[model samples]
Target: MNLIETTYQLNQKAKHIAKVVSVDNATMTNIQLRAGEDIVEHSSKNDAFIIVRKGKIRFIVEGEPVVVTPENMLHMIPLEKHDLHAIEDTDLILIQIKP
Candidate 1:
């Protein structure tokens, strides 16, 4: 088994960080965002889901706002257009699978 640490280990200096922690049958990415930062609007290239490790993020999906907190996880289908805004300092893991 391989263990990967989150923002604590990988994102100490940047406002936004995206790293592919694993890639075999699927890809696992560690993403971090500092308070007030946002990921530019884009489309999911593969089937994906986000596991929130800390703080909150607002997902704007096709203009609809969906707030996700530490208690929540968000999933998206391939090619879905979306944007992510950090409501607070946040950390998450994005698992994407090719379909």
Candidate 2:
């Protein structure tokens, strides 16, 4: 996955912007989110986490919202639903890992 630069188009109707950075070993998937965008509440069987790489976010993980800025990290355990909204021009690192 180091060599595989990928992207997953989100809901255009919801205005979510993102790109898949890598999907390593099928157990870990890394994604990057763009500003003025959001990730709607959803969940998977795996554990999920996020790292704020740049800017800020009004992040909602498991039904709670918090302001997260650069260098901050958020984690969502297995089966947890979440949503993330960019509070400004921002970038984020999203990870989905095997339980």
Candidate 3:
């Protein structure tokens, strides 16, 4: 078995991303963003599940904005247009699964 760390580090001031796990059909990515940082709109060919580990984010899907926090997770279907803006210092994990 293998182990991976999925925690946030304090005092993070810039956008950070790391791919912690990858296999034939899926991947797990860790993303950290400071307040006001954003990811430009894009679409993924694979289905995506986003889990907010800390703080909050404004997740825009197809031009609709949804606030995401640690209490809930977000899922996006394959090829859906989306983008994210960090409402505050945020840490999240993104899991993508191939069709």
Best by lDDT: 3
Compared with the true structure, model 2 gives a TM-score of 0.65
**Candidate 2, clashing residue pairs?**
none
For model 1, the superposed segments whose C-alpha errors exceed 4 Å read 7-11
TM-score of 1: 0.86
Off by over 4 Å in 3: 7-13
Tell me each candidate's TM-score.
Answer: 0.86, 0.65, 0.92
Model 2, which residues run further than 4 Å from truth?
Answer: 1-35
lDDT of 1: 0.81
Error of 3 at 10 (Å): 5.6
Tens-digit lDDT track of model 3 for 1-99:
998987675464477899999999999999999989999999999999999989899999998999999999999999899999999889999999997
How close to the true structure is residue 14 of candidate 3, measured as C-alpha lDDT?
72
lDDT of each: 0.81, 0.62, 0.91
Judge candidate 3 against the unseen true structure and give its global Cα lDDT, from 0 to 1. 0.91
lDDT of 1 by residue, 24-49 (tens): 65888887878788889999789888
Greater lDDT among 1 and 3 belongs to: 3
